[model samples]
Structure formats: structure tokens, C-alpha cells
Target: MKIMEYMKERFQNLEFIPSIYNQWGIGIHFCLGENIYQLKEKEELNLKRFQVVYEQITIIFNELFEQNDDIFLVTNMYKHKKEKCIRKLKVYQPFLKCKNQKCKNHLNQILVKTYPYPFEINKAEEYEMQQFSLLCKPRDLRVTELLKAASNEDFPLKPKFGGYSTDYPDVFFVNITKDNIFFIYDDRGCEVIALDFKRIRHLYEKYHDWVEEYKCM
Candidate 1:
């Protein structure tokens, strides 16, 4: 079956749910090359347009996952202007500090001395400490390493700042696990959703002709 047909079947089966809040409605944003298109509930959701957007997204994800096992899909939200609806999908790598043993040990000592009781630092403070550490040693270090040394996994490090933008509400993070795929949406109202990836994967498998076309060009 074609990808749009497959997606339509899934929609009929109620496999996916639309994102709808009291004031704000849910929509799908597409990033194709430099152009962006949106299928929003407020503007009347177009199934065909949504299918096309999702097909493009699936192709991008399949290509990316082929190169790397893990990645993030970032979508930028816009409220009033369709022209400003810019969606960006890219690879996300968590910041890691030092991989070396000696540097790791040195950074651990610094954390022990500075924040003995497990404290939190803002981005500015974190940067300052990173600079201080770099000046103090021959060993290379990273801010993430220092963060890991100071905090336990259960109580991991978190950013001090809050989400920005009233116009652009949320950012999505997609990841593939061994058994399933999942996504997390971070938003201003703390509106978050975690969903399975099967529906999307099915769409990708159904319509992958664009992949061959791109490869040829």
C-alpha cells in the first residue's frame, strides 16, 4: 500500500490521537529542505497535506537512523503566521565532558570540594566553572562530566532556566529503542506527550520511493 493509504487506514483504526487543548489545537509541522508546511486544526486539518508532511518526515527519520541509531526531531511552533512556521529536524547529542580517566578524576575532586551536598548551577555558573577547571589543569574536562560527578542518576542535572516563547510553544524529541520508538514533547504549559513509534514506522515502510529518488540525484 502507498504511505498515504496506510496512514489513512491507521487514522480510521484510531491508532493516533490529535493534540487538542482547550485553547491551543494540535497540528503536524513539516520541514522539507528549506521550506516548512503545517497542517493545523485551527486552519482545518487537511488529511492529504498531513500525509505528505508525515511521509517526508518518515523518510528523513529512516535515512538518519540508518546512519545513527539515535536522533532527535525538533519542530518549531508558530501561532499567527504560516510563513514563520519553520520546523527543523536534526541529530541531538547530549553534552559529554571528559572521556579520559585522569581528567574525570580531577573533575570529580573539584565537584566534591565545590558542591559537597549536591547543588544545582545555572548555565552561566556552569560555564564559569568549566572555564575555571580548564585554567586549573592540563587534563581536558567537560561541564557534563562535572554535572555527572556531582549528581546521582535518580536526581540528574537539570537546566535552571524555563522554556522560552509564547509564540513557539513546544519542541519534540524522538528516539528509537530496541523494542519500540517513543517521543517526548517539551512545552511552555508543561504539556507533554509520550507515544509509541509504530504508526510512524509503518508509514515510512509503506512509502519510501522518495528515498530512491534522492539517492539517484
Candidate 2:
């Protein structure tokens, strides 16, 4: 059976119903109803909820393993001690192809599944990237740059963080480089090519002032 089908079946069997169902129907969400229950009551309820979620996750892992033992090797479930709930579930194997094929040859990649009990469910792509970074080591300088750029939205020349230029209309070209260096060019013709990640990150933090100045100009 497919992963989604397995998950759906397992979730359906659970006694507690999911508060929200994802639009794709593949993802399930359960809220702790923090407002309705007291802290101690919530903790007790969450522990029971975690047990159910963990069982469902284990079922999924077993299904994945049955499909391809080599593809899915490690399965781990983590819970928040204070809240007494499962926060994340990770399933991974060595040298797996990324779903996006961005890192086809990279080793030790992981897939993270999070519960809505602890984390807010939004931006699925961003969460996937975050999980990928946590599980896999950087294979090369280019991979390193891409991961860093994705995580740090405030990076130089990032359009999302208000880094833009009329000179370079295509923001992607300006932010990403063939040489794995970030090139930042302001409207004043001043340029900064950062080879080191730390240096570039520091510059990213400091660039807000420059952005303010540029806006005034």
C-alpha cells in the first residue's frame, strides 16, 4: 500500500479524532485544545494522544519498510517531556534521492513528520527543507550555499527579506551563483561578494540599515 493510504488507515483507527485534516488528505492534525483543558489535564491527555500518534507512525514506518527495506532504515519518534506529547517523527536511510532531486547523491537524508500538538502546521516546503538540513550533511559547497540561503531568508540579495535591485531584475540570479559565492550589488554600484557563510550571514544581519538607507535614496 502507499504511504498516504497506510497513514490514513492508521489515523482512522485512532480513538481520538483529528481536529483538522490537511487539504491534501495525506496529512492529519490533532490539537490538544489547550484553552479548554488545564495544564495538568492537558498533560495527561497529551500523553495518551502521543501514544496513539506514535503507534500510527510506527505502522507507517513498518509499511514503508515492507515496501523497500533498503530505502527506509531508521525510524525515531521524539516527544516533548514537559508537554508529554510527540513532537516529531523521523524516518531516514543512507544515500536516498531527495523528493525534489535537488540532492540525488547525498547520503544520510531524513524525512521528518511533525505533529500539530506542538508545532504549527504551515509552509510544508520550508519544513521539508529544514528536516533535510537536520538529517543530511552538506555534500558540497553548492549544497551548503543553497541550504544556508533557504534557511536564512534575510541573506543578501534575497527578495523575500527586502533585498532587491532594479539593475538585476531577476533576484534568483543575483542571490545564487555558480561559484557558490553570494554576490550583493546595491543601486549605488557598491558590490559585496561573500565567499564565507559566516561573513555573509553577518552581512545579512547588518544589511537592514543599508536597506533603510536605500529606501530613503
Candidate 3:
């Protein structure tokens, strides 16, 4: 699939894989590519990054699983947003978004509500982390559309600072046993990390010249 065509100005790759464990990864910033089409300078590169990472993740998932295999999706749920609509007289999105009627039927129709987090001043709003996930085949949801649109809508803030560590506003986590792939879209650029060489070297080599240095992330 062809994304926008652009020239590389100062493309630098970030490689940091834990040696103590398995899961080595390499990533690049979106800004490195000069004159990218349809991307605003100040805005986060959501679709562009998703497009690349989705292809990689699906390929990796396919490598490990089978044509009929069901991969797991652990998408983060917005606690703040959930609070806003929790008390209203309507079904919460997690329930509504479910495709299985049987599953939806079992779920209680509860309105969304918001209760402030009670804790220290440092952690005034950093601990409300919840996720809605599914275990199904890749084709079921056409996950690209669901993720490209819903994830951002669900969790709008792409955490630049510290909030909920688990809740990466614009990041997507792909886990396979101990090995994992992190789709980090909020950072410098669209980066995909393959842990412990779980099949990421090729990705890294694909952009070898652009890779900069290895840091301790």
C-alpha cells in the first residue's frame, strides 16, 4: 500500500530493546519525512502511523497464528469520557460497540458517569485506567477503521507527559505471548517496536539508513 511520497531530511530511528528480557524494537519519527502529504505540522500523525503499523502488526500476527486464528485486542477505555456519559440514560459505548448480540444482551445497559479520581495531588488524574478488548479474527472488525477513528475519539489526549502510564492516548499495544509490538503514534513519529527480535530486524533494516541510535527507554 502506498502512503504519501516524501524525501528523507533527517530521519533518525530509535532502537531500544530490553536485553534482560525478550522484545527488541526500532521506531522512527513521522516528522523525519519531509513534505508528507495530507499531514498537518502541529497535529498528531494518527492515520499515517496506523496505516504502517497496522500492516506490520497484521503480518506479524499472521506469522505467528493462522488464517482462522483469532488475535487478541486490548484497547484502552476512556475513563474520563466514560465518566462524562456514565450517568446519562444511554448505553455505554463498549456495550454498544460490541458486534455480538449475545454478548451485548448479557451486558447490563448502564449509562456512563464520571467520578473524580481520589488521590494525592501528584496523581490527581492518573489512575483511572480501563480497557475494552476482543478476541477475534483480524477481518471481523476491519480493525483499521475501528481503531483509526474510535481509539482517538475514545482517548483523545495523546499523552505527551505523565498521566496514566498504561493509557497511552495515541499508542496501540500488540502482544503475542512474551513478545510484543508497540504502535507509538503520539511520539516523534510513527514507530513500531518488535520486542526481543520477535521479527523486527527486517523492519529495522528496511529503514537502516534512517536509524539513529539506541537509547534506554
Predicted candidate 2 versus true structure: per-residue lDDT over 73-114, tens digit per residue:
112232332333222221222223354455443342333444
TM-score of 3: 0.44
Model 1: per-residue lDDT, tens digit, 1-217?
2222432432223121112121122212222312233334686534454344334444433432343333232222222222332222110112223456754553343210111111244332322110011112112322222222212111222321122122212222223322121221211011111133333344335544322211100
Winner on TM-score between 1 and 3 is 3
Count clashing residue pairs in model 1.
Answer: 0
Ranking by lDDT: 3, 1, 2
Off by over 4 Å in 2: 1-45, 67-217
Cα-based lDDT for every prediction: 0.26, 0.25, 0.35
Q: What is the number of residue pairs that collide in model 2?
A: 0
Deviation of model 3 at 104, angstroms: 4.1
TM-score of 2: 0.20
Name the lDDT of candidate 2: 0.25
lDDT of 1: 0.26
Error of 2 at 169 (Å): 32
Candidate number with greatest TM-score: 3
Listed in order, each prediction's TM-score against the native is 0.22, 0.20, 0.44
